[model samples]
Structure formats: C-alpha cells, structure tokens
Target: MGATAIVTRFAPSPTGHLHLGHAHSALFAWRRAREAGGRFLLRIEDIDPLRCRPEFTEAILEDLAWLGLDWDGEVRVQSAHLPEYRRALDALAARGLLYPCFCTRADIAREIAAAASAPHGPDGPLYPGTCRRLSAAERAVRLAAGEAHALRLDMAAALALLPAPLSFAEGGTRIACDPAQFGDAVLARKDVPASYHLCVTHDDALQGITLVTRGADLRPATHLHRLLQHLMGWPEPAYAHHPLITDATGRRLAKRDRAATLRDLRAAGRSPAEVRALAGWPD
Candidate 1:
C-alpha cells in the first residue's frame, strides 16, 4: 500500500442480525475502498458482552459475503483487545482527565429530576457530575472497596489540555469540533470495560483507516471522537456519514424494529442482487 492509500472500514455491533441499514453502510464503505483500489476492513464491535453473541457475529460475516462484498484483511474483533482499551483509560487517568462515576441510571435520574436545570445532550440528559465532585480520598476508598463504577472523562480538563481547536475533514471541508457538549463522556464501566467512543477512535488509528462512513445519526459523535484522536495524537480520518435507509413509514431499518434481515430476504427467495438494490446499491 502506498502512503496515500484510502483505507475504510465497516464496523458493526453483533447484538442482532444485519438489516438493510447495516447492508447500506457496509456496501458504502466497501465500494469506497474497492473503487479507490484501497483496503476495506471488517470489525466486530462486541464490547457489550451481555448483548452481543458469537452467533450474531458469525451471521454478520455470512451476510456480508452473501452480499458480494469482500474485505481486505482479517476482521478485527473489539472484545479481543481489552488490554489496549484499558491502557487508554489508564493514560487518561494519569492526566487527571478521567474520574470514577459511581452513579447508576436510577441515581442519575433522581439527581436530574430533583435538579432545577439538567441540560440535554445528543443522547439525552447529560450526566449531572455528581461523582465528578468526589474527593480524592473518597474516590480511593470507594475504588478500594470494589464499588461498581464507570469511568467518565473530565470534559473540561480534557478540553483545557487541548493546545488549539479540533476539527476533522469531511468531503473536502473541515468541520470544527466541540466535545464539551457531551459532558464528561463515559470511557469505561463496570459491566463494559470500554465504550464505543473510545474503541472506535482507537481502532481507526490502529488500523490506519483514512475514511469513516456510517449513518448520519452518529455525526454528533464525531465531535467527541475528534477529541479522543487529538488527545491520543492519532491521525484524523475523513468522515462520510450517509443517510440511513428507512422503511415506507420513514422508520430507519434496525434489528430492534424487526426490519427484514438479509437472511430473511434470502429465505424468501430474494436474490442477492435484489437485496443489494433494496439496500440502495443497485450495481
């Protein structure tokens, strides 16, 4: 591969089967790499052990192959790289850019409900910073006691560490990033050691992916991802967020929505070509 090779990837969580939206995103990335004579990679994002199953991961690979999409390298599974994510968390902690968050969902909801003002973020109500105020001794005691907690980024501290404003390339334009709106984003938790934000950014840098193509819904997350790349000194990847594939009623195709899976269509006698067209890739 040359220095200017355009590497792209299609990373999907294995919580469920691949629907039309997944097909569209995968096809988009694969075409971008194949057309440019670059590399297209596959990654299984199975960080959430409780939700992700091996069977789903297997099904994803089969579906992609059946769709006539071929990738360039061995699929990178996120679960197999726990230590790498841990090191990232440790590095952030060393800089005092991370703190243990002991609040559970119920605790956070109660705090937000009782508060006079709780600002909202792209996902929902932002964290109220209850544990962000814990004293060093108190935090140490709780950590030593093995209390369940999640690691949250000290957003303000992280921003302060930045030498200048952050931005990323998108379709030949630079978009400025403001990660502060995420408000102390979670990096790791008791149940899940790493988060999507942390893992995606780390893997993109590790894999040398030059372009990131995904659904438009995740565009907001690019801001936080940019911050992580800047903090870790990772090369910034140009992003091309595509519009989601929706059904007749405008609902996006999703496994939770019981949208038609590729296998479902295949079983119903729909050929691969038909499915590709349905996924918005006629050719």
Candidate 2:
C-alpha cells in the first residue's frame, strides 16, 4: 500500500467468542480497505484484565482468519501500550482537563436518585459532577492517601480549550459535536488504568487510521472522540457508522444474549461463504 493509502481497522474486545455481529463488523472494515488497496489493521482491545482473556484474543484471530479476512501488519494489543495511555492522561491532567473521580457506582446512583431530575446522556444519566467539585487540597490528600479513584475529563474545561467548534466528516458531510453530553466522562477507570475512550482514540491516531468504521450504536461516542482528537492535535478520520445486525426478534445481537457464534455455526457445517452471507456480505 502507498503511504497515503486508506487505513481502516476492526478492533474487538476479547471478552467472548466471535459472534455473527463481530463477523459483520470485521467484514465491513476489511472490504473497505481491501477493495481500496489500503491497509486493514486488527487490534485486540484487551485492556480490561478482569474481563478479557488471552484465549479469547487467540480465538478472535482464528475466527477472522477462518472467515478469510487478512489484515496488514502485526495486530496491535492495547494492554501492551499502557505507557501511551498514561502519557495521554498525564497531558490532560497537567492542563486541568482531567480530575480524579472517587465515586463508586453506588455513590453515583444515590446522588442521581437524590436529584429531582437527573439529566440523561447516551450512556444513561450523566455524572452529577460529584468529584469535579473536590477541593485541590482534598484531592491531594486523597491522592496521598492512595484512595482508589478513576480519572474523569472536566468536560467544560476541555470544551473551553477548543479553538473552535468541533465537527467530524461522516459520509462526506460534517456533523457537529456535542461532547458535553457525556458529562465528566471517565478517561481512566478505577479497575483499569486506561478507559476505552482514551485508548481507542490514541490508537487510531497512532495507527494512522484514515477511516473509522463501526456500528451505529457507537456514533454518540464519536462526538467525544472528536474532542479528544482535537485536544491531542491528532488528525481527524472519516467515519462510517453501519447498521447493526439484529436477530429476528428485532433485538441487536450481543454476546450476553448467547448469539450464534461463528465456531458454533462452523460446527453446524456452515461454510465461509454461507457465514459471510449471514454476516450481510457475500463474496
């Protein structure tokens, strides 16, 4: 591929086996890059040690290869690049764009319940800014005490730093961004040092992904991602949000639902061509 060749990727979390929905997403990204004579990269998002397993990661590679999908370069693993995410969080922290959030799920729920009307965001009720109001001295005391905490973006502060309004290209059109909707979104989780938002945007920029292809369910996340890209001065990539494949019940396919996995389908005598067709792509 040329230096300017289009680059796309299919990043999957190895929390479970490869389902039909996973195949559809992989095929969508692979075809885009392969047909354009560009690069299709594979990334394993195994940052969460508690849920992700090495066996699942290996299974992902096996299933994709079995489905006749080939990618360029060695696969990028998020866990292997912890320092990079730490650098990102450090940069934001230095600028006062990030704050330590010590609130647990139970704490947040109680706070939201107390509020007469809690504002909702794409992810559900927005954070009540409980930790954002912490005094510098108190935050320092907690840090010195080693109290467990997650890092949250100061949404207002981050938006104020933008030189201009943020927007991104989608299907040759510009879509305005509203990142504040994710009030004080978490950048680093309590259990994991890095959050998906921080790692994904950082890796996409690091990998020079010129096109971001994923499910429409993540379109809301694109708004916050654009904000991160602007904050880090990373190049913007065109996005293509595709429709999610749903079961006959009109519910989206999900691993939690025990969706028909590729391995199971293969065991049932399904060929690659048949699986590809089932994934909404037939060669």
The models' CA-based lDDT, in order, is: 0.94, 0.96
Q: Candidate 2, residues 1-283: lDDT per residue as tens digits? A: 6888899999999999999999999999999999999999999999999999999999999999999999999999999999999999999899989999999999999999999999999999999999999999999999999999999999999999888899999998999999999989999999998999999999999999999999999999999999999999889999999999999999999999999999999999999999999999988
List the RMSD of every prediction in angstroms: 0.8, 0.7
Tell me the RMSD of model 1 versus the true structure: 0.8
Per-residue CA lDDT of candidate 1, range 1-283, in tens?
6889899999999999998899999999999998898999999999999999999999999999999999987999999999999998899899899999999999999999999999888889999999999999999999999999999999999999889899888988999898988999999977999999999999999999999999999999999999999888889899999999999999888888899888899999999899999999998
Candidate 1: residue 115 lDDT (0-100): 95
Clashing pairs in 1: none
Candidate 1, run of 10 with poorest lDDT: 251-260
For all candidates, what are the clash counts? 0, 0
In candidate 2, list every pair of residues with a backbone clash.
Answer: none
